[model samples]
Target: MGSITERLSKKDIEFIENQKMFFVSTAPKDGKINLSPKGLDDTFKIIDENKILWLNYFGSGNETAAHLLEDNRMTIMFCAFDGEPNILRLYCKAKAIQERDDVWEEYISHFSTKRAARQVFEVTIENVNNSCGMGVPLYDFIGQRDDLTNLYNKMSKEEHITYMKKKNLVSFDGKDTKLFED
Candidate 1:
């Protein structure tokens, strides 16, 4: 069975902190929905019972940021693949703070990434829910991958900026991500 709550309790926060990865979902008013798997150390932070922040590294698509521009609706999900059988969902309204934004530095400081972050998603949680995830398959825990960090380390700042301008500026559905545009 599933249960809904108004806020994230301490136990909930602890569960989030222990999870290795989570999925972020977002969508425009009318278009393809975006669900991304995010995994990296210190990539996510629980700002409070009602707020959460996650660092958005450069990727092939910028759908989440673009979708946020069109609509604030977002959902984050975490499933326990070890020790416990629980799945948690956070229903939220989110805003993408791009690298060019004034407050970007503040949020970026929460993460330690060698790769240039395209944006930081700030989510205001509206509802919290948890359900038994007994059906979810368990997997062994492994160390994080360094491919992204290695690639970013090789690129100069200008090259990184150019790459973001080219690839992260637009969503798959033709929506602007506002990554470079003020």
Candidate 2:
């Protein structure tokens, strides 16, 4: 059985804080769904009872930003991979904030990452679901990979932006991410 609530309780917040990784899911009105595994230090934050922030690093795809632009609905899921079997899910609407935006620095300050961020997703939680994840297999977290960050840090600022424009400006479905919009 699962319990649904309108906001995160103390227990829920604690569970989220212990999590090393989470999944972000989004979809356009009518197209492929995007589910991404997000894991990095200081990338997730609880802004309040109903708001959260996810610091998104540049990735191979920009489906999340594109989908959020088309439809704000999104879901974030965190599972206990090393402790008691529990799952926490947040159903929400989200918006993409890029570096060009005025609030970018404010949001970027929330994270500590060497990789250049592609966007910061501000998520408004509409509902929360907590459940026993009995079916999920447990895995030992060896460590966080530094390959991505190291690779990104090798490039100059301009080169990094160029890479993003070339590879992350559009989703696989051809939807524009509005990553460079004024």
Candidate 3:
């Protein structure tokens, strides 16, 4: 059975910080669900008991951002794959803050290093829950892949913008992400 809480406890925060990866799920009112695996150190931060921030990097699609625009509902899940069997889920309302947004600089500072940062997802926690993940299989911890960062870093500013316009501006279901729109 799972237990629900209003906010994250000290123990929960510690577990979150130690995890190497997490999953983000979102969906529009009538489109396909989007569940993405997120990794890379320093990409996620806990602002408070009821708030968290995730720095999103360039990806093949911008489903999360698009879905947030359509409906703010989002859920982030973290699993303990190498240690004790546990799972944590934060039910939240998320806002996608694009690089062009005025508050981008403020939120981006939370990350030590930035590369190909597409957006900053500000999540307002609505509910926190934990369940025994005894069924989750253990996996060895490996280092993060640097290919995505390296590819984006190699592009010039104009090229990067063009790339985003072509690739990251729309969801797979044809919803506008509004990433570059004024």
Report, for every candidate in turn, its global Cα lDDT versus the true structure.
0.89, 0.90, 0.91
Off by over 4 Å in 2: none
Off by over 4 Å in 3: none
Position 49, candidate 3: lDDT: 96
Q: State candidate 2's TM-score.
A: 0.97
TM-score of each: 0.96, 0.97, 0.96
Lowest lDDT 10-residue stretch of candidate 1: 110-119
Candidate 1 overall lDDT versus native: 0.89
lDDT of 3: 0.91
Candidate 1 lDDT, 1-182, residue by residue in tens: 99999899999999999999999999899899989888988888899999998888887889998898889999999999899899999999999887677887788888767367777888899999999999999999887898988888889889989888889888999998887777
Task: Give one digit per residue, the lDDT tens place, for model 2 in 1-182.
Answer: 99999999999999999999999999999799989898988889899989998988887899999998889999999999987999899999999988888998898888877368888899999999999999889999999998988888888888889989999988999999988887
Output candidate 3 Cα RMSD.
Answer: 1.0
Candidate 1 has what TM-score? 0.96
Candidate 3 weakest lDDT stretch, 10 residues: 155-164
Residue 101 lDDT in candidate 1:
78
